[model samples]
Target: MKRFTLRTGIRWKITIAIAAVGALITLALSLVVHSAARVSMLESARETQLDRVQYISRNAEAGRKPPMGAKLNDPELPQELRDKARSGRRGTYVQEKPRGLPEVWAAVPLGNGQVLSLHSQFRESANMMRDLDRALAIGSLAVVIGGSALGVLIGGQISRRLRQAAAAAGKVALGDPDVRVRDAVGGVVRDETDDLARAVDAMADALQQRLEAERRVTADIAHELRTPVTGLLTAAELLPPGRPTELVRDRAQAMRVLVEDVLEVARLDSASERAELQDVALGEFVARRVSALMPEASVRIVADEIVSTDPRRLERILGNLLANAGRYGKPPVQVDVEGRVVRVRDHGPGFPEALLREGPSRFRTGSTDRAGVGHGLGLTIAEGQARVLGARLTFRNVAGPGGTDREGAAAGAVAVLWLPEHAPTTTGSFPVIGVP
Candidate 1:
């Protein structure tokens, strides 16, 4: 259980707020009621004592003596009362805890040069005040406890609803277009939270629609250009074997590659790609793929763990990563496989800040020195392929050892692929990864 603090959570804040307000109101009411009751009880006791003193004085004038339970010449009489009686006027005084009783004393002057005093024990009124105090205390406590509990309930409901909407928004931000926030507190009780949920759902729907339209446009463009690209390739092949022909052939091949990448991206967007899973030793699979796709790169297998995955999709991901490293990074590109993780490190200027931050976009090359080097679709396709294989792809910059660089700057870029050991069985769809 966490201790409650103002900063702990919205629920605790709400609880404390309600408890504080309730306590203040209870305290105020208790003070008002207690003060009024104490004053009224004390006044009534004094009036009764005064009336008894007057009656006793009247009796003394008629030659009547003190009553059976009355005390004459009481030693506990206050001097103030005696002085008032000596002046031939009625007087009253209160003695707290006199003779084991809280008593109100009143006195009157007798015509025969004597004084008559009457006192009333206020024990019953004192007990009533004490009981009132106890009730007020108990009522204040109940108000605080009940108010706090109610605050927790209301705050928890609001927080839970907000969390649900936030989680759905997170999924949307991560490229999961199918996510929607459920109407937890449905119709007729709607408020701002419901409005926020509705807005988030609408935004996700709009994003999904826009992405679908873009995918359709890409697929259509790629489909329409395939025949023309094939014709260009064939025409270049028929040209005489010369420098001009080689140039034409190279350009044609480049165009073909770009078209293929665009088509693959469209398929990924449309969720048309499917994975074919198989059990394979992670170390061996990585070794084979690196040798075939990037024979020049160094390989180090620290652990051999078998993982259930799609081999072809895995190859596609690794191939693109290796190609990117070879084209843009410095020499000594290294591939390390340990357990279910595969990391490719290149001793080049680490990935550009923008590239690492915003991710790869088609045709936006990160290398300024080698401008127009290659289409930026390599990493984009690799990321999409990794997702299909139920793996995560991440990139970061790694710094070299101390004093290695003259300016002491970062060493290179590192791309990591985390493949889970046990892949869940999917029927016919490629599972979206790196998204919520």
Candidate 2:
């Protein structure tokens, strides 16, 4: 599946969102840490300086300079501060202003009214604050980067599923009625993905059913129109002996037949999902069928079998085969029924290889003779009926008198019709309807 490009996907959107949020949190944390760490360090520095002054105050002589004097020099001061010891009103004040240092001034009073002062340039506190700020910034950045990566990955997953759903939809739109998306989670996902997959499947199935229904309706309408036209033609032929009327009647009859054939195909193509369940007898059924086909035609039936089927539909199937046999056979249609197998052999030349290969497709007349012959749909209807009945109809080219390549330069096809085994317990009664 094709995923969104880097420039388009949710990965970056999520990453940006993560970074923004993480940055805010990290910034606040960094500031707090910087402030706390710097203040604590400064406090410690001040306490150490005060202790030095206290030591000097205890040892200092009333009239002489304190021994702690040298320790107050720039190198030894809290932050390399410059200083000089002098007594102040509260104590001895230490004064200094070392370049580039934070100022610190302090004094300790003596018991004899003298004092010690600790003063220095700007130093300690500023350095501690700077280091703390740097640490917080680094830590916050690391966290933001990690959060962004996670967010982008999550967004990519969501987008990928969505893309698959989109692809499935496209296929459905293009007439791929079987297109369906699998749920990322079992039993219909709890989210949009589940909804999308279900919707796609539902759409494809509904569309397929609708198309099938329309095809069937069209075919049924055509098939139903046939009888009336055929009747009308027969009535017209009886009315007059004129060539004009005869030609008109014949044309009308032919059109009616054509219309009927078209409709029959439509019906077969459009039949419901499955056929009606009913039992039919195949052996006696074949004998009666062959007998009815051509009177005095050499149609023989050796065995009688029975099977479950739609009687009306089954009649249509067998009638088509018998009619074709009578039309093309040289002498008489031969009908052989043994159990579930019904074989009708005719003296007609076998079908060509090409026709056999095409099998029982619609409109395959196998002959180009444009005479009174019906153009290919009867067999198509037969095939469709057989399919609906759960039976098999196969067409093969059989040799004539000389076992030569009848399929290559032969006349017609040898069609075999097979049904399931359904034997009647009694010869006179209709076989039991169907298998339990």
**TM-score of decoy 1:** 0.84
Residue-level lDDT for 226 in candidate 2: 71
Tens digit of per-residue lDDT, candidate 2, span 1-436: 9987656666678778889999998888877787787657656666666676666656564455566342322344332122223333222223344655554455554555433556544365676677767777778878998998888877776677777777867765644444576533234325667776787677678877887787767666776777787777878877767888878887897788689677767655544435565566666666676567555545455665557766676778778876776665444556667767766665566543455677655555665431145576767788877766667888775554555553335444567877754422322123568668
- Model 1: residues with Cα > 4 Å off, grouped in runs: 1-7, 59-105, 112-124, 174-178, 183-188, 367-372, 401-408, 421-424, 427-436
Off by over 4 Å in 2: 1-239, 273-280, 369-372, 400-412, 421-436
TM per candidate comes to 0.84, 0.45
RMSD of each: 4.9, 15.4
Q: Poorest 10 consecutive residues of model 1 by lDDT?
A: 401-410
Q: Give all candidates' CA lDDT scores.
A: 0.83, 0.63
Whole-model lDDT, candidate 2? Answer: 0.63
